[model samples]
Target: MDWLNYHHLLYFWVVAHEGSVSRASEVMHVTPATVSIQIRELEKALGVRLFRKAGRGLVLTEMGEAVYRYASEIFAMGRELIDMVRGRPLGQPLLFRVGIKDVMPKVVAYKLIEPTLNMPEQVRLVCREGDFSGLVADLAVHRLDVVLSDTPLDPNLKVRAFSHLLGESEVVILGERKLAQRLKENFPDSLDRAPWLLPTDNNVLRRSLDLWFADHNFHPVIRGEFEDSAMLKIAGKAGVGVFAVAAAIRSEVETMYGVELIGKIPSIKERFYAISAERKLKHPGVVAISEAARKRLQ
Candidate 1:
């Protein structure tokens, strides 16, 4: 491979950002033809086409996306370097991009990320909520600094990342005040034939709860199953049915949803994890989150 020309890379990066050579030329104060030539030279040096045409605009190819990711990081670091050399106090906060799995309880996610806000170095948090697989893909591509999930990353996935076990919490059952008062009488036995809101069967928590139910021989009447934890809690809050949450955030759940605690199931615990591209965490914000979560959950 030939030595990389940073000038060519800068042109390519600008064109990617602008989505067209003409717009990139306007930003860089160069002719459109100049930008095109520079990008073509970069493509030739890298031995791969970077952009593809779509609706009179350009979109990045798979390899192009990968290159763009690197180019972004490189330019970001370069800007930071210039700031340091100029002795300019960096008032701008560092960005901490994270992904939260959709099935994760919103309150739990907030607790895990809350410590980063108090760090000595300022940090701006950006959260992306999606399915675990999609979040894992973004983490693999370096788009997300970390991912918060109830379950650890599956080894079956080919992504190169490490799952750091933040900690685990016992599951706590909850219900509206009146329903909880009624069920609190019999404790575990009261769960039988009780109206219950539940997570969809595909969720890890739901699967674990299913085993616990089977072992205890409890047959609760299912009111509804939800993919969103917040919606399930909302239904539970309206006296739709009882639901469960992580004991670590039990107080917040009750306060936020105006629900009462039915009981805690110590036997059934929910684990939390932080998945990142690096085995050894380097980001200060990520480290703060991991540390805080372990302490809180423990």
Candidate 2:
């Protein structure tokens, strides 16, 4: 085996963990072809086929499975070494990268940690925004130090949950009319009568809406779908349709777009969690951010 092939092992590890070249590519921010070529090169250098086709996805071969077991440990140790080097008495501030669900209010989330960011031990805060699954995947890959999200995580992930509150709110939006009389007149008994702006099908909020409709024997007339709440709010304000907005965001919606809350619908209360890998709880940056989120968002 080529002694310099350790770099390739990192690539292999990502592919194995992600279960697909395309997914690994997205996580690594590389092309699928690049990931495939590197994996092939790693296999060639090691003189074995690491994976074989299993239905639509790749499954590890016997050799591949054994290699993966060791690869995980090797990469983990490598990360520890890197951390050790960075944590040395350099007297410099340590940068902590944190991810938050885009659905969350950034002002509230940041204010929670504002004090910690100015500690004597230089602490730099890096914030990223994404949906629940994307943030979790980034955390699993070690790309993000910690994540704050309103969605529950998979049991397989090793996470420390700091907040347990089930925050419930209705999915509502300001109707087209600002005047109370006009809004009251336009209110419909069933949402099916109005064109609705919904989040993508995969979103937890969207799923809750679907469940509510099923229970109530109503189907919304979906005018369009959006991935971002800000965009949906814009569409709602423009009278494109009634868009879903969390109660937490109602004030922003009202202030920004003059949207009037027409009615409340039955939707599941969202659960917000400040989660990090169980192993990373001891890391000062992770600990600080987690505590901050728990204090404010919980």
All-Cα superposition RMSD per candidate:
6.5, 5.9
**Top candidate, metric lDDT:** 1
Segments in model 1 whose C-alpha atoms lie over 4 Å from true places: 1-89
Writing each residue's lDDT as its tens digit, candidate 1 over 197-297 gives: 99998788999989989999999899999998889999999999999998999989989999999998999989999998776777778899888987899
Task: Judge candidate 1 at residue 223 and give its lDDT.
Answer: 98
List TM-score per model, in order: 0.72, 0.63
* Predicted candidate 2, C-alpha RMSD: 5.9
Q: Write down the TM-score for model 2.
A: 0.63
Q: Count the backbone clashes (under 3 Å) in each candidate.
A: 0, 2
Per-residue lDDT of model 2, residues 1-298, tens digit only:
4385887888897888788999889878999999999999999888999999998898889999889878866765666677767673577567777888876645335544575676668887788988766777676666876776666666654322233232345455455564323445545454655678888876677888788778767767788888766677777778877765665556666778767777655445544556664444655766665565444432
Clashes of 1: 0
Cα deviation of 50, candidate 2, in Å: 5.0
Q: Best candidate per TM-score, number?
A: 1
